[model samples]
Target: MNASDRTPADLLSSALAADPGRPLVTFYDDATGERVELSVATFANWVAKTANLLQDELSVEPGDRVALLLPAHWQTAVWLLACASVGVIADVAGDPAAADVAVSGPEPESLQAARACSGARIALALRPLGGRFPQVPEGFTDYAVEVPGQGDRFVPYAPVDPEEPGLIVAGREFSGAEVVERARAEAPELGLTGPGARILSALPYDTWEGLNAGLYGPLATDGSVVLCRNLDRLPGETVDQRIETERVTATAR
Candidate 1:
């Protein structure tokens, strides 16, 4: 699809319809030595709910930035898709202050900023950040529990304009239009599509390569994207398990 026409939501919907049963994301937690799998259909539902919560509870409007400090968990995927569905700008940061809403994980720099910036209204965490990372302080709304039952379905706030920025990648910025353009330009050489094709990537969602190539690009072409949580904790076996278990067809770096 052309850059002007394609959107992150369009790509996600395509995957949900084409392979509702297929594993869309597999997150391996080394500390717990467990795997969490999310199928396209289930993920879509969660994303919808998340979108509604952000809109209704937090009043996150289109183009508003939500910063993510979480790991490569299934929740992170859901958050990204949800933000895209509602036309909110998902600004993933290593530091939290740069974001409007903060999703805490291993990093806390951005979370601190989110608090200092005064724009941060909501904070989401898969687990408490007592010691795992810096605390988001008190008074900030905890999105983990508050968001689950807020919305039954996702309502599109606005049709995504590719020219508008969909996500903040790396330390730089890129618009949705840029991502679709890059995907189309590189798809032929990268071999980024086709049946049974899966992409395994260690890149963080905060990076351009990860957001475009790792997540959205693969989804656009009916391929699965495997996001690894701990890139440093590896014996190659973990990667092998994901490949063997998920039947990953390809990898990008």
Candidate 2:
């Protein structure tokens, strides 16, 4: 059950087995004053449903490329794991035109970019409580609307190979095994030295460093992350207060 030699999906399964109720991802949107927390069980459930949606509804096969044109939101984190579970290569902030599937946020720029994808297109409203968009975007399935109808459990039709490409961030491709290895390697440097280390990250998800700090590093250590978006909008005092309130032991900014 150790994450050292396993894929991201295996790591998640191990985390769920270790403690389903433990908080895994705690997200904050400083601009919108939004905060949402997901326990390991809840996060895994979302990943399963999203993986089912990708596999059953979208018909995504192993090695398919999925462009993730989203920010560092909680739902975005779920999508990363779902892509891993379904054996799809997640291209974060990649060109939608070249992808087999594209996932976009509700922002106008992301929506505009997602329209180029000839394959399946999905959109997230990124609303509190995972609410659906008031009006679904053109040619895009609403994730919040579709995911809930999917089954709670997921099993990939094709087993995920750890050596297969799993993630692409900033145009750097990494296999499923490399993703886990990189996460583990970056954990200590990112101050995720021990289990239960709470890390507060203000970095964007577009870079390897950001992904490591915001998602993978903490996960590798069986720790939790306080992921912040638009953190620069908040005052220094407010940010400090949040660190104290969240019991953050480390910072990656």
Candidate 3:
């Protein structure tokens, strides 16, 4: 399907229709070595709920920017799709100093930068962090415990325009906009679709390359993403084991 012909909602709907019972995401918690999985049906519902909360309760509007400081986990995937569903511009900034909202992990540097970031308004820290997100000095809202419960459905603020910017990624000296324009430009030849197609990505969610090439790209076509913590140091045998276990068909670095 073409970018102009479909919205992010369409992507999720199609995925659910194609394989509602298939696992869409599997997150491994390195701390306790626990595994959590979400089927397509569950993921679709979660995205809908999350989108509703962000749009209705948080007052996030279409084109409004929301940054995610989360690690490469299933929640990060949920947040990305949730933002997309409501036409909110998802800013995947590597450094919190470049973001508006920060979803922090256990990393103190990320937490500290999120607190110091100039434009930040909300900070989301996972429970495992022990609520240690650096105090959002004056003038900021600490959303560590303020997030609303998930709603049943999402009503998009506006129609998604392919030309509109979907995500913003900050570089060392400049930021780049990865709009649906680029997604359209790249989708056809990439074969980013179909049943039994799976993508394994270990890149951080805060990078446009990772978001587009890894997450949205696969979804845009009709595929699922398999997220891993880090692929750099894994032994070759372990890498093969992951691929076999997850039935991953492709990988994006």
Q: Pick the candidate with the highest TM-score.
A: 2
TM-scores of the candidates in the order shown: 0.82, 0.98, 0.75
Give the per-residue lDDT of model 2 (tens digit) for 35-56. 9999999999999999999999
Q: What's the lDDT of the predicted structure labeled candidate 2?
A: 0.93
Please list the Cα RMSD from the true structure of every candidate, rounded to 1 decimal place. Answer: 3.7, 1.0, 4.5
What CA RMSD would candidate 3 show? Answer: 4.5
Off by over 4 Å in 1: 1-5, 94-99, 106-110, 127-137, 188-191
Residue lDDT tens for model 3, 32-146? 5546678888888778877876776677777766767677777677777787777766666545565545555545665665675565355455434225346553444554444
Tens digits of per-residue lDDT for model 1, 1-253: 2223466776667777566898776665565566667788877878888888877777778887878766566677788888878887777763455556666543355445556545545555555221121354464666655665766677766677767877776767666666556765665444566655677777766666666556666666666677666756877786687678777777765
Candidate 1: the clashing residue pairs are 95-109, 95-110, 96-110, 96-111, 96-114, 97-110, 97-113, 97-114
TM-score: model 3 vs. ground truth = 0.75
- Each prediction's number of clashing residue pairs: 8, 0, 1
Worst 10 residues of 1 by lDDT: 128-137
User: What is candidate 1's TM-score against the reference?
Assistant: 0.82
Candidate 3, residue 17: how far the Cα is off, in Å: 3.6
Clashes (candidate 3): 1
